[model samples]
Target: MRPVPDRRLWLLVLGFSVWGSALGFVYVLHSVGCAFAWPANAIRLGLGLVLFVHLALVGLLWRSYAGTYPGAPAVDPTDSFLNWVILWTLIAAFVTIVFTLGPTLLLTTCT
Candidate 1:
């Protein structure tokens, strides 16, 4: 038993593992020629570009925004936890999006 925080970190790791497993399955389906729509490469490229812009906006805002308070408690556990959750969720989503689109773009453009 590590600790509550460590356990939460493990849970987050598990969630990412599940996500990777699911993406792997999708790749298998794609390999066997079972994919629907055949995924237009142009669409993948366009969407990837759009996603990049969105990610850039998020990064800029994340750096520019400041929520610190002078009289706030030393450490608000709930706020910290929520921030971690939100940040990791966004990171996972971006990773998945890139993984999915990268292959599609390559397949489309290469073929």
Candidate 2:
């Protein structure tokens, strides 16, 4: 089995991966909603729902972030650093989604 320290290394990519996926998904969703000539409220509602779900998923990722499992031998300081990096990366991703796509929820795009 891979060393525990390196097991979580793959998580480094998770934060921005989610953010980028959300960015593309939000853009496409909004575009489609506008193209369909959907009602203003309906479009915004859809946007709101998507944003909510994305945020929730990111929150879940935050809850799941861990650089080292408990009960295992303590790793070097890099493990704690990894923990902080994961925490902040997720935070940044969450904030980026909120500040960028969240505004569309409060405003109409199909009107």
Candidate 3:
């Protein structure tokens, strides 16, 4: 019989996927807004909301993966390649967040 996949692995995959999608959605929203010449403030506000939600989701995922807080599950095994993938995924998501939000902070107009 095949052994069941680790719960931690599932968590890692789910977290990465959600975070990645959130990042993509933020950019897509911005592009759509710009395409129709929506107000700059409106686009910024919408993107800001998306960033906030993404950060929240990332926080939850970090807590689940690291398990540093009381009552949290133990950290996943370090030996597994999946664990490394999770770590890289988290890093990539954060980088994406910075790239996605930096323009809003520095620029006031879509052009």
Candidate 4:
């Protein structure tokens, strides 16, 4: 098993995952009749800012990942962070498409 992460790192990851999931859930609601249009870019910016702050706070915690743990392989922390940023960007794009194009598609079938 991997070593237990420090409390702060655990908390940081939990916070980000929850924040992202909550944002995603709200996007889903907007999809299904929540009335408000999804501001995908703005929400993406907010997520980026939150991630930056969290990373700065937990910067030290990432040092441990430089080397392999007992069972885990070595990982590049920078790449991992970048990967998450890219993943979030893609999700934002998908949400944007849903909000922008989905309605048009819905409108077409009825007319």
The candidate scoring highest on lDDT is: 2
Clashes of 2: 0
Candidate 4 lDDT score at position 44: 45
Tens-place lDDT digits, model 4, residues 5-38: 4653443344344435544644554354323443
Model 3 residue 61 CA deviation in Å: 0.8
Span of 10 residues, lowest total lDDT, candidate 3: 67-76
Lowest summed-lDDT stretch of 10 residues in model 4?
102-111
The Cα local distance difference test for each model comes to: 0.49, 0.77, 0.66, 0.42
Of candidates 4 and 3, the better by TM-score: 3
Top TM-score model: 2
Residue 63 lDDT in model 1? 40
How does model 2 score by TM-score?
0.79
Q: Return the clash pairs for model 3, or none.
A: none
Residue 19 in candidate 2, Cα distance off native in Å: 1.3
Runs in model 1 with CA error above 4 Å? 1-48, 58-73, 109-111
lDDT of 1 by residue, 1-111 (tens): 222455445544543444454455445545543344444654454545654665554454344322432234664665455446645654665566567645654554223
> TM-score, each model?
0.42, 0.79, 0.62, 0.31
All candidates: CA RMSD (Å): 7.5, 3.7, 4.7, 10.6
Candidate order, TM-score descending: 2, 3, 1, 4
| Model 4: per-residue Cα lDDT at residue 18 | 41
Off by over 4 Å in 2: 1-7, 66-73
